[model samples]
Target chain A: MAPQGQVTSVPDDGLTTRQRRNRPLVIVHTGEMKGKSTAAFGLALRGWNQGWPIGVFQFVKSARWKVGEENALRALGEVHERTGQGAPVDWFKMGSGWSWTQRGPLDDHAAAAAEGWERIKADLAAQTYGLLVLDEFTYVIEWGWVDVEDVVATLAARPGFQHVVITGRRAHPRLVAAADLVVEMTKVKHPMDAGQKGQRGIEW
Target chain B: MAPQGQVTSVPDDGLTTRQRRNRPLVIVHTGEMKGKSTAAFGLALRGWNQGWPIGVFQFVKSARWKVGEENALRALGEVHERTGQGAPVDWFKMGSGWSWTQRGPLDDHAAAAAEGWERIKADLAAQTYGLLVLDEFTYVIEWGWVDVEDVVATLAARPGFQHVVITGRRAHPRLVAAADLVVEMTKVKHPMDAGQKGQRGIEW
Candidate 1:
């Protein structure tokens, strides 16, 4: 029923245009104590299964010892074993310069944290991974330790194939505008206020 | 040099104690689009202002549409206008669902659309919302329409002080999980892929 010179053949099997062009950048806004880090861990595990290289960046106020980050790393190990993707890369923790235990001016400590953010920026610029997770990086901006504009620029400049996931509370409107996906984890209730201290395997 | 046994009476802030005692329930997940109804909208906005009468339940497929909810509702003046509250009451969305126009079975439509999750759960219980925002309720649970235990339980058993949010993607999960808030919307993506088209403002 086609014209004499018209080509009426369908494209080859197992390939589609949408799949070829679908590259996503996800932003997750985890409100206070709603397990944003845990969700990131789940995504990392899934990415590892697909043989995607991943980078983890933790930028928070006074990062000393967070059990959630540790659990995420341990989960990465399990993912590695399941997928045979070799060992997972260790996370880079960019602290707020001053230790939580020591309460002082912390000018020098703040400088170190700034340097760590630079390192993260550089890694993102280099485009070294299929997925990158920026954990609690929003707090750095909130505390005036990092420039939100610079972060936005870096994300905008990323290569098309790279997928970036940023997590934190109180994300800026600018960041939300730049993101392809955003999830805000609002906390309705928490157990800590009811005379219950942070419990292992739950709060951590 | 204070006098012995001089009792410094502390003013009892009743808000904190009440908040702790009530302990609002929160449910977070991904579901179909455009499933949450006006009831969910009213509760989320009103309960947030009152304090301690809030819950966030999202049932969307991917974590993409949350920003859309914020923008649309805020533009429509649904969200509370003031500040200084300990935490804001707002509905959050999560997840990406399948494209409707794709060449799939029509049987997947209801599940993909999340038809019944929002109303059945949120409205039936009637107690879950001081405020509720069901971000995406339909599409997430479209595959299994008949089996929705969690939805029933949550709707049937939620506490009086709780507000609910229900977004639509697939309602199967939502139906089993119960919702005090429900929303549903048609989806239209950017740049308009072949066989896909969208109007300005409506799609965005």
Candidate 2:
């Protein structure tokens, strides 16, 4: 967190500073606390400022829920289109036609999650985005909807300079191992702990 | 982090859910890791989307450091000006003419920090912003440049619906006690631990 951006340790990875700096990263935001997805979206904001194309795929949350980041980031995309200031942004969520195939039950969240993973795999293969945010993706892995090994391997071998950030609670060990940076958002205190209900603007 | 935004516990405070939900919050982001400020800026993005005017005050970091959020948020302000979207944004940092009233040494950071805090007090009293981000302000409090008791008292008794978010490592105990929500960004694993250098787009 230093202003100079100091590295804590220099590895024997044999890569030059520039090479190490430019290397693509896999970041994981996990733990049972708030700000996991929020921090990932904040990174997307930073990536957007760098003119990096951002792709956000919400694995768990339904499209019906109107999160504030969705509107703000989509608005930023419009600004990019109009003023050519930031880069383009794409947002996708589950329960929004991922059930088009109608495989078995209408509440087949597992199947829908698998479909989302396939899309992410395709995007990774195509190198379609500079930053790919898999918001709440750990749930899919935790629920056995998606294979953690597959997710980690695909991200490790992802082509180009695509940086992927996964956010959710109880992240798989393999995913954490594969991540370059991992932050566990720990709750010291929450309004909910004091019996306060979540607000529209603040929580959403 | 539920889609339904369910409260873990309901208080017996006699307030309706609507009133409790409408209450303003004081959030503190503290720990020995990255994304403290980034998560705060993410909240600012949500606030801006809610049409809440945002005021950012940088306490420790100098004005010369070009962080990405500053540009993105300022661009968002421009978008608001052009298209009548979001809300107004204002950003301030230290070492940028708070020295104009120096009474002692040229490197009197304590005086500068105190002056920066005075402006915040004035803004809070005037109810100038719906969201005020005191970025890295905890450092000043940690260094005893500003009194923590005064800060807690002022924020606890601040007028109107102003929500304040303070971000830094090692937040004061009194401030944390006063906050409605507190998140400690714990580092599970860092690229720096493996000797990876910080990158331009990723770090800043």
In DockQ terms, which candidate is top? 2
Worst 10 residues of 2 chain A by lDDT: A97-106
lDDT of 1 at A183: 53
Q: Candidate 2: which docking quality band?
A: medium
lDDT of 1 by residue, A34-115 (tens): 4455556445544443455667776664423444444434444444555554245446554433232244443564565577
lDDT of 2 by residue, A1-204 (tens): 655888767879887677767889999999888889888888988899888999998877553343678888888888899889889999887865443344443367887889889988998999889999998899999999999999988998897789999999999999998999999999999999877877877788
Residue A62 in candidate 1, Cα distance off native in Å: 5.3
Clash count, candidate 2: 1
lDDT of 1 by residue, B1-204 (tens): 557876455337444544544444443333222212322332332333344334444443442333433432332222223333313443332223233224443354455445335543544376534545554444444445434565566555765555444444344534533432222222222223333343221132
Q: All models: lDDT?
A: 0.48, 0.86
Q: Which residue pairs clash in candidate 2?
A: A11-B195
lDDT of 1: 0.48
Q: Which residue runs of candidate 2 sit more than 4 Å off their true CA positions? A: A1-17, A63-66, A98-107, B1-17, B62-66, B98-107
